[model samples]
Target: MGDLEIVKRAIAGDDESFLLVMQVNKEGLYRTAFAFLRNEHDALEAMQEVIYRAYKNMHKVKEPSYVKTWLTRIMMNYCQDQLKKKKRFTINETLNEISIDDGTVQLELQEALKKLSEQEQQLVYMKYFQDTKIKDIAVMENIPEGTVKSRLHKILKTLRQHLTEKGEMDHV
Candidate 1:
């Protein structure tokens, strides 16, 4: 079913519909939250809270079509609150953990991804990691499609430069 139909049923207290909502968007939502929180543990906690909040306050959502944005906004707020509490560094620990199976070049790309600005990182994560369309990202970021395109271009260029400068371009 569509998100709107799912939301309508969820609002009407159909628990299965609510679970369906979770099943459909959980991975995307978790990845988006992870972009902001950076730690899997913290991101999971925030996602759980977001789900609880969304469930409890479903009536407050004004439009059926906006459920995705609404849930994201809730997750964003929860992430911000968690950030304030943590006062974490720019270099999140999650980014530091390297996998041995990935090659050196892949590792370099991972490190380069870690170097991106928070917004740039989010854009890359939303676009590549979560496979979100640029239009949807523009809507979610409250920016124009042109801006999203421009940012992606600039971020990709910068990431390549950073990786090359760091001698990790061979990985790519």
Candidate 2:
């Protein structure tokens, strides 16, 4: 069935249809959550809360074509709330990874991402990691598109400087 069909089903109280939505987007949402929260357990909790909230409020959504955007908006809010509720914890020296290619590069990239502030990390993750477009990210983040571009540009510059200062980049 098409995405619209699924959305209609979900709105009509098909819990399993909601599950399908969650299943399709769960990995992306989890990774996005991880990018912000940085704690696996907290990310999981936030994602769960997001899914639950989405399910409860599915009826409020008026457009069938906006399911993806709507879901991401919910995820972003859940993450922000989670951030506010939890006293932030410092990440340990070591970060985890599951790279298919160069582990060194992956580790460094993860380290660089961790160096970013939470909002910047989320912007980077949504833009590149989840392959989200700037406009969509802006909507999901409830920010202006120009702000998204500026934030992403700033994030890239920061990451480049950080990697260079740390000797990860020689000619950046």
What tens-digit string does per-residue lDDT give for candidate 2 at 35-77?
6676788788888899888988998887766677677767876
Candidate 1 C-alpha RMSD relative to the actual structure: 4.4
The list of candidate 1 runs beyond 4 A from truth reads 9-16, 30-43, 56-66, 69-96, 168-172
Please give the range of 10 consecutive residues that has the lowest summed lDDT in model 1.
90-99
124-145, model 1: which lDDT tens digit per residue?
7667776678887787778999
CA lDDT of each candidate?
0.76, 0.75
